[model samples]
Target: MNVLLIGSGGREHALAWKLSRSPLLGQLFIWPGNPGTASLGENIPLPVDDHRAVSDLIHQKGIGMVICGPEAPLADGLMDFLADRHPDLALIGPGRSGARLESSKEFAKEFMLRHGIPTARYRSFGSREAEEAISFARSLGLPAVIKADGLAAGKGVVIAQTREETETEIRAMLEGRFGQASERLVIEEFLSGIEFSVFVLTNGDQYILLPEAKDYKRIGEGDTGPNTGGMGSVSPVPFADAALMDKVRDRIIEPTLRGLKQDGIPYRGFIFFGLIRVQGDPFVIEYNCRMGDPETESVMIRLESDLLQHCLDCHQNELNPGSVRVSSSHAATICLVSGGYPGDFEKGKKIEALPQTQPEEHIFFSGVSSKDGQLVTSGGRVFAVSCLGQDQLAALDQANRLADLIQFEGKYFRRDIGFDLK
Candidate 1:
């Protein structure tokens, strides 16, 4: 069937790449896609924010499914608009009510507390309550998790390790560190644990688990410094054995699905459980209405099933657990970014030294534009080089080596992508 994929990032590139290989796929169209996606499908320039225009094109092109790859569009009620216009259409993201889980940190916190989902204790404060928020932050002590209540790309969160840092972050957020996104803030207690992600495709009640992954968010090595979109990721997480997964499924995943249903919110799309394992127990860190970026790049590589078929099953409310498949091998993704990324940086740099990847290695584009017949950097992150191997060490080793081969001016990447696992 003809499919329309929204967004232009590494996550979308990974999805498009996997979807292109499906035998069930017909015409695949990526809206405002990057160069990598262009090689796999027709890249259409559509005004996604203009919901009517997008829906009109979907009808014009007879697209059977619409897959949203990012959180912004989903938070903007894109799915609600399309579902309203085309009730029978397959939409791969949730509507506005469901999107609040990611769009508004306050809403998610309330939902978790109300539904008895395992999560950190948090309190929300409006812009006027900066002092009140600061007082709450002190109560949580140092290493407080301060989050912008609204969408701020993937960089809305701050884990302040010091009291000064905590107060500064809270004040900055209240005073508009992220514009309107930070007008309201959610101050959460810092949970000490190793963080990971769990992905699933669901029709509210029934669901199929995808590969779990862990992404390095900090721009610097050793997980220091500020968070960028994502520096790198590893899939089929080594620590996510059967015991922990069972706790995650029962304590977090099942409760989440039940809560959504009890709230009477209709959902049919990817639900990314940003979780942390604390002393062998699983606790939710956040919920993303869509898949995580660098994580998606690695997770998609481990999905052995036909991507299109699984999505269709969810849309048709026929998700069969028997049809789901995941690779036993490890997968790794190294996100090559502009040198001064997570900060001011120049774009339009020439990219060269492109390598002919082996069967296990692949490069997925994130942010680049074709200028004067050359691929140039257009955004902070440039490309995601991924590799599959028998173990985490081999997968990350191969991915790191390939990451070095693809060169660009001001290119930067972390060599210790999956090192934490080791």
Candidate 2:
């Protein structure tokens, strides 16, 4: 089957790599893909918002399936547009209603509450409710979490440590700190726990859980400083044992699926559950309509199933518990970023060179572009170095080593990826 993957990031590159290996695949096409993805398939320079152009190309290329790798396209009703215009085009993504789980934090929290899913206490507020939002934050106390109600490229959340800080953040958000994304806000009570990511492939009621992963979201070492998209990730999370996984499935995942079904929402795609374990119990932190970046680089490395087959199963509404297969081997990914990432940074810096990688190690580009015959930085996150190993320690070691090999003027990466598991 011919597939058209949307997005230009580490997650899409990893998906492109895995999907390329499937024998069921004929040709792969990436829309606005990076250099890493360009190596695996034909990269198309189509704008994501140009639905007419995308539709025309799909028909022209006879693309069998459309796999959306990021949340923005999903939130923009890309699936609905395709479904309405070209009903025969197999798509691996939820429509706009289902995408609300990620596009709007307020909607997700309310949906969780309505469905009795385990999550932190949160109150959604419009800009006019700034005073109420502040009062709610004070009630929750310091270390409160202030999140922009709409998507803000993963940087919409702020973990304020004091009442004053919380108030200030609330005002900033309401006053257009994150533009229209912050017109509304959701204030959450800080839940102390370690965070991890859970991905599931679902076709409405039927679903298959993929490998679990934990990603470091902070921009600095020791998990200090502001949050970035993701600095690093590890699959087969050491702390997510079977017992805790049972709780997560029953208390969080099951309830979420049931809620979606009961709400009459049509869903057929990846559901990324942002979870936090508090005293061995899992609570949902957020939901993503698509796979998580950096996490995908790690999780895809450990996926043993044919990626194309799984997507087909979901599209045909045949997804089952046994449809997914994952390797027991550990996987790790270290994200190399431009210096001063998650903040201001320069782009188009020449990439002097990249070291040769072992068979077990791989480099997935995120924010890189080929200029004239040389690669250069184009975004904050530059590349994700991924490696598979017999154990988590070995995987981290290999990934860290390979990450250090990539050379660029402002290259920087956290040396302590997956350190907590150690």
Candidate 3:
């Protein structure tokens, strides 16, 4: 088993390329990994808030399963500091109170209004409630959304549209523009439609859902500007049917895993959800303990199972809804970025040209870094490229033809990735 896999990007290089095609994989680390997870194995640059140097490299490399993959090291508790500095490893994720559903968007909208689930209609305020959060964003009428109850990496959401751009971005996110991750502010209620991504793999109580991406968090191209961290993605989401995934598994993933196991919260890993699709149902537009960058690089290349046996059956709680499989072809992940990305750019730069992929395309890097040996640019969504066709318009035409054979120096992307399923 011996895993580790924390985070560097491109969803930890697509879960270190599906945990290096597990045969119960016996050794694969990553931590500060990049260079497409250094060809799927040993990367560990350490210092993830130095929990005793990640518990002395998990007892000097006898790792035995970790799998985090970001949400700022599972909202900084780092699975309760590696389960109290190494309770025989095996973490996967979710512990800081089930990572406050995703680091508190007002505790995931009051734990989705205390478990009835379906979301949107938020309210959290603080920073001395800026005049009742500007009178609750002028009573939610024009377009409104504001968010930033913590965590701004995915650009702490905005969607303003007016009411003086929602009281000047809620007094500039409770005054600080995301410092202290916007010292409290939620506001929401602009729910319209179309947005997807589901993932699940829980152990808060038997779960396993995966396969249902749909990224493009607007960096321009018809979806207008601002908001990045995902420039493209897609995976069987031609409107997520199956009667809206059985109303998102009985109205929002079975009451968010029965309200995180009736609030005791021993969650195991990956919960994402995000969701949107209005008219046809499903709501929750947030919650992401992990897995959802370019929709995990297009759902880990259509996930043909064996992601280290579903993270060792979610660390032995033995998750099972027929144990994950998913490969109905049609993937597509694009990403590229670096040209004034999410705002401001430039990093190592080099990476001259790249392409000639084809074994159903792949790439995966993300903000690169190898230097002297080549591959440069280091962060603002750098390379994803995934392809695999036979549908989603031939995987968005072979993922924009391998994202135009990769160039570097300010190489933005999104040649209309999955243009809302054409």
Per-model TM-score on C-alpha atoms: 0.98, 0.98, 0.33
For model 2, how does the per-residue alpha-carbon lDDT over 1-422 read when each residue is reduced to its tens digit?
99999999999999999999999999899998988899999999868899888888889999999999998889999999999988788899999999999999999999999999999998999989999999999998889999999999888999898778988999989999998899999999899999999999988788899999999989888888888999999998888999999998999888899999999998999999999999989999999999999999998989989988999988888876776778889999999999888899999999977888777788999999999999999999999999999999999888878877779988999988888888
Model 3, TM vs. native: 0.33
Q: Local distance difference test, per candidate? A: 0.91, 0.91, 0.83
Candidate 2 worst ten-residue window by lDDT? 316-325
lDDT of 3 by residue, 13-78 (tens): 888887788788988889888877888888877678776787778888788778788877778787
Stretch of 10 with least lDDT, candidate 3: 352-361
In Å, residue 14's CA in model 3 sits off its true spot by: 10
Off by over 4 Å in 2: none
lDDT, candidate 1, at 167: 88
Model 1 is weakest, by summed lDDT over 10 consecutive residues, at: 44-53
lDDT by residue for model 1 (373-421), tens:
8989999999999999999999989998998888898999998887788
